[model samples]
Target: LLIMFFTTGSFADKIGPTDGNIVGRETDTVTLKFSYETSNEYILLYWYKQDTKSTPQFLLYKSARSANSERKPTDTRLESTTTRDSTELTIRGLKLSDSALYHCALR
Candidate 1:
């Protein structure tokens, strides 16, 4: 028996908050923008906070390509806003976890 795997070409670009200079109190909220490009394939968006190690932990938010598909509920500390063509992730209640190199990946 033989098994094979398929992969797609996709990339994400940080549109906002690239300065990495978040100006706000802990009680305040911060918003970040991201853009992604894929080969007409389904895309998934996720957020994470860098830990002591070189790895990100937890899924702050997520979205699908289909409107019918159930949308991922935004956490009380975070929220996401998207457009008809591009994806925009807005995080709320800026917390320590909200601070990190946010990335948008297409699957």
Candidate 2:
């Protein structure tokens, strides 16, 4: 008899504001870059708002699989664009609410 196993994980890296500047008013764009080792999977990029006593809320985008995915919440203040495979995310019209830890995962 033989045994085999499989596992899944992601390689995440932060992009943009890498200098840790207090990103808020005046910041026009936020960009992030990441790389992964998987194929035929969808990637979900999320943004949240950090609060003192509560969980973060969704800020700008979600469920983006390709560089051409559409922005959500339709306020015309948030926009996202990406590059295939390389995993680059470009966000426009950044606001205070757009401040939070950005995360990416394969789904």
Candidate with maximal lDDT: 1
Could you say which candidate leads in TM-score? 1
Those runs of model 1 whose alpha carbons end farther than 4 Å from true positions after fitting are: 1-21, 67-74
| Root-mean-square deviation per candidate | 9.9, 11.4
Tens digit of lDDT per residue, candidate 1, span 1-107?
11111122243422223334445556565565545444443445555545445565444545546532324544655566655345555556556544455454444
Evaluate candidate 2 by giving its C-alpha RMSD to the native, one decimal.
11.4
Reference-based lDDT, each prediction: 0.47, 0.44
lDDT of 1 at 93: 57
- What lDDT does model 2 reach? 0.44
Q: Which stretches in model 2 have alpha-carbon errors above 4 Å?
A: 1-27, 41-53, 56-75
Q: How much is the lDDT of residue 43 in candidate 2?
A: 55
TM-scores for all candidates: the values are 0.58, 0.46
